[model samples]
Target: MLSTKSFKGVNVFMSRNLVPPEVFDALLDALKLNGADVFLCCDPSRHGHNDFHIISSPDHEKFEDLKAKGCNLLGPHCVLSCAKEHRSLPKQGFTCCLAMDGIKVLASGFDMDEKVKIEQMVTAMGGVLQTKASVDVRFVIVKNVSAAKYKWALNVLKKPIVTINWLYQCWNEHRVVPQESYRVLPFSGLTICVTRIPADKRKEIEKIIIQNGGKYSAELTKKCDKYKVARRWGHIHIVTRKWFDHMS
Candidate 1:
């Protein structure tokens, strides 16, 4: 069938390293549903003993089809990384970096298979793997932070280091996700609250609160973590001077 989904003339790439066949097919299907032209090929560097290329037919034209072909023309910058920033979204615009070079990714771990799996995940999800560390590296994914490379990322280069959870989360969510959720910080967690501090004090005090590991909320909902009240708004609690004194 002729695809109704508009790739806007974009192509996607897949990596063939430690990846399951089912996952590969699913990835292409998902992309096709969202109107993305897709490919099931891998970085040419990865051709050793595994399947890196999908035997595509020139007559075929469907996103989900395993035999997806690559054409002479790809959209723009070969942007394979899925991110909320700029034109990363499929519909707005895509770069198909996966087909070209993929995202500049560095994987660190003890298990070679695991490392390969990570590579597969990245390429399937639209990322490129760099063989080594460099200024061009955009993200360093680590399952073993104890590795020397992880420390280099931490101390020497001061690179943006992310855990393997970041990758799985993105795959599960099927979208580019903010790294904040994968991190744990002293005051990083968000806690929405309906606060009753006066407008002037609210901003100032909330700044202090946020700095000290708290969050704010505008709506009074069940999902709200805390509530401050000038009057009894249902079962909400009112903070007294004692509470302020305690906070101080």
Candidate 2:
């Protein structure tokens, strides 16, 4: 049973761009029904000191401003999870990992108890846990990389396989750490460099590369295995912007 007093005395400010209109309405109604003092806008003067500001992404324009005002920034899933769990969850690090919402996941090498726990956490965070590896399953959480299911997910289905630790890390930190860092050396022994990319995109790519067991060079270097620019280097593989899209 869902608890109506989950958000009892909490003040929540939902961004208008947090979700689609219908989805936003549903979330707003849910927050109110769960006993939160919901606000449609970020009017700090009207809210208390412990107010939470729910935004679409941490990159939202108001993120720094909200942080400066000491407001808790969280994703929409935090509200849903808190409501379902019947308590106001800790808002720390919630905004850092926004990809969990609506993500389709499959568990590959876990016992019954572990799988159940994984399902509970995933669903609580607005993620979908699948019983089988389907085309739509975006990620496969595995206990053993050598397991048949893991191989099928990686080699056959071409799905990104991550260890159970990835899930636990995200839960513990309240933020989804890079899954590539928990994978089995997916890009081991590779050095990559990015150029002519937007600052935001470059940061994302660099993080992914470093997490996947690769080194990132801000400038073109002779040791770079992959260079995302029009540089004619015989040893380096020059790629276009589309490479980022394909790799991601």
Candidate 3:
């Protein structure tokens, strides 16, 4: 399907790699769902030890049938090169770099010395570098997906913040270690009033509190400074000092 056909300013370039049978199934599904077309690059080296076969009937099931055809999988090198070149078109848009198992690796990692080559190719094509997370297939949207990237980064870089909020709401949700990471910092000499559960639970909670420059209470008495409640984790809430202070 490498015919020189284009759609919506986006070009599909299938690599010479022997795509796993299941992968082709997913690809067909994605194409139909996203209304995308296909492009194929012919490379003998990528065909493994088996000869290349021309698949005219590109359907989900047909793609799956090719799985046991016994050909080895091809590397993504051809596709990566095409994507780099595609980035040069002034209106080519974004080219998403995808990988398997929702694990994304930067195309730049393939050949670090060619960094300028890829960047220049993208700049000329009016696109950017982005990775996609997909269990079956990953790819970049080739446009400004910075918002998506930021969302991913937040979850990865601020996992502790997320864990803290999650554990605070329901200390019993996960193992005690999670709760132990959260501490209630006392302010204005107010003893934090907390529900005293068990010795182990109290110890874990107290450790988190002390680490964060806070104190813990053994019982929910009126003399307690503030109430530390692990509430439903709202990611944004976890990032705030107010949440930390309140929890502490």
Candidate 4:
């Protein structure tokens, strides 16, 4: 399986496989944002090609697709060994010959067992193991923003660790139904849940959601739902399980 690892805040990788275009783009964007550099290596022979070409110019006609996606091509140099140098240089280098500075190895197509061995070596040297999913880092609004904002609050409620169901009950009590949505980002393991609610009531719950770290849930259950009702008639009621039981 292909996976990613982060080492000393650098991105490094050796791969015989290529990641999806979107995932690759995400990785480049993240590297640029974090001031990390990249070293991509592949064996042209493994790809079963000999007449290979490397495009280095930013506006190179051969790399229109990669350029359009904001990837700036640096100089291309052949990976040569003592024997290979005596022969004609291939367009691309083998995985072993590729090396660069300021790069923390990111992803590899190595098998799982080998990857674990590599990971152990890295961690032993104080490096970190990032899931292949996280190699392509992307921004997440839920954990990235303050919970006081209702949009973030909704996210907190949906997180796995926070099993609060009261918020959902509050919305239901106010006749508000939250439409369910999920965002699967390149970098995150869990699909982020986005709920739709009325604009005005957002501030009511956003106040609490950000304060809790992805550990809040919607209050929709009788066993633990705790909702507060605010009526235009100035009547406020603290909803509890007993009330739900009594009604049942």
Candidate 5:
């Protein structure tokens, strides 16, 4: 449960351009319900509220500056997306980490249960876990953006740094989401091709890819990325949607 005291005198800001408009509305509503001094910076004339102030620009870097002034970030990945958003999510039964197999990840600044959840998320995603950051660590998941590991991943290795929410969002969507929408990034890049699915669903899959900073091709090429199919394509990289769902 949220308490007014928890949010008292706290200023919360989110990047309007990074968050989809629909999601922005819901996020604002949720924050308001929680008693947050929440503000969304976009066109100021629109979305004015008695409860919070609005910044009229899309300069997302303002959010970083606000952090220095004691503002809390509360949006998906705490960034805006330059990708297209689909009206619908992926089909159910599909889980989060189908493309994650053999990938390596590290978790930092999370408690024991949260740490276990990270391990489970990676393991379910078919990724290996490491004790600490290393050359082998491809994904670093953290709750606080200020964590050392998160900073190191973003600044030093330039690897994918993502929030724990990335895992939950991926689980809900049943496909890997775009890294740009995360606080850090869950993966470097992923590409997928589909087969044996309805035409409408194929489009949804493509939206998942594009919104997450991946390129999609209409036709399968010999040298393209992974292919998604119910059956194997003569050993061309592939995984059944059922298997992808079971990855969680």
Candidate 6:
């Protein structure tokens, strides 16, 4: 049986459209029994940053707006599941937004215990875990960028190689967070060209770029043209040496 205070600190707002009246009443009872603070309407002024909004549909008009406001939107089943388990279940499995569904993941440079946990969480979140780097692997979770699997995933497979913390954040948040902040190679997907620097200094820069998941070119190419078009469209940035130094 669930403890009376299983959800002591949880604050939830259930949309009237989320479930039938009878089901909603039962859920309300369950939430109350489990010591959750439940709200019938979503009033921005009344809710705090930690409050969850139980949504009826992902395509609801206010979905994007609520998400932008950092609201935790979840399906109705998430609540029932938590009540059943007597604990807070990961929202990824119960929500319609299966963040890692169909994503193939490979783990590298982690010990046995960590790998086991990663596999369990990835599988639970509807992702496939691969023991080796392969064509189908879309993401590589790495502790060390110098790991052989990391090199193969980044260089040969051209897959996104991210730090282990990325996986943990996704598991904790029950969604796949942005990769830019968690990438093992922050310079991934960039083509860097250095000019006006000495040859020795240029070599050092090139090494840094490659090590950080970037490509270096001696001369401009069609790739640069594509990036130029991207820049003109405001899709890409052309930063100065000062910015580069700050980032480095």
Winning candidate number (lDDT): 6
Q: Please report, in order, the local distance difference test score of every candidate based on alpha carbons.
A: 0.49, 0.68, 0.33, 0.31, 0.52, 0.70
Candidate 3, residue 37: Cα displacement in angstroms equals 5.1
The lDDT ranking, best first, is: 6, 2, 5, 1, 3, 4
lDDT of 2 by residue, 87-120 (tens): 6645553343333766899997678999998986
Q: Write the per-residue lDDT of candidate 4 for residues 121-184, one digit (tens) a residue.
A: 3332223444532322211122222222223333433331111122223222322123233232
Q: How much is the lDDT of residue 70 in candidate 2? A: 67
After superposition on all CA atoms, how large is the RMSD of candidate 3?
A: 16.7
Alpha-carbon error at 143 in model 1, in Å? 1.9
Rank candidates, TM-score, best first: 2, 6, 1, 5, 3, 4
lDDT of 5: 0.52
Clashes of each: 5, 0, 29, 17, 9, 0
Q: Residues 1-248, candidate 5, lDDT per residue (tens digit)?
A: 43233334434455566455666766566555545565555323322222222222224554434334433222242111101111111111111324464678888878788887677556544466788789888777876554658668766878777867777776565456776577542212334566658998887777765654455656676654434431356754566777534421
Assess every candidate by TM-score: 0.37, 0.42, 0.22, 0.17, 0.34, 0.41
1-248 per-residue lDDT for model 3 (tens digits):
32332123333434434454545655444433333344465332333332323232223343334435432222223233333333211221221221221222223122344544444333322233344443321222111112333234324432221222322233222112332334222231233334534566666666666655444556543553322422432221112434544545
Candidate 1 per-residue lDDT over residues 43-160, each given as its tens digit: 3332222122332211224222332322221222222232212232432111223332346778775478888777766665566777788877777776544454776776676656
Report model 6's TM-score to 2 decimal places.
Answer: 0.41
- Candidate 6 lDDT (Cα, 0 to 1): 0.70
lDDT of 4 at 118: 49
User: All predictions: root-mean-square deviation over Cα?
Assistant: 15.8, 14.9, 16.7, 18.9, 17.9, 14.6
lDDT of 5 at 126: 47
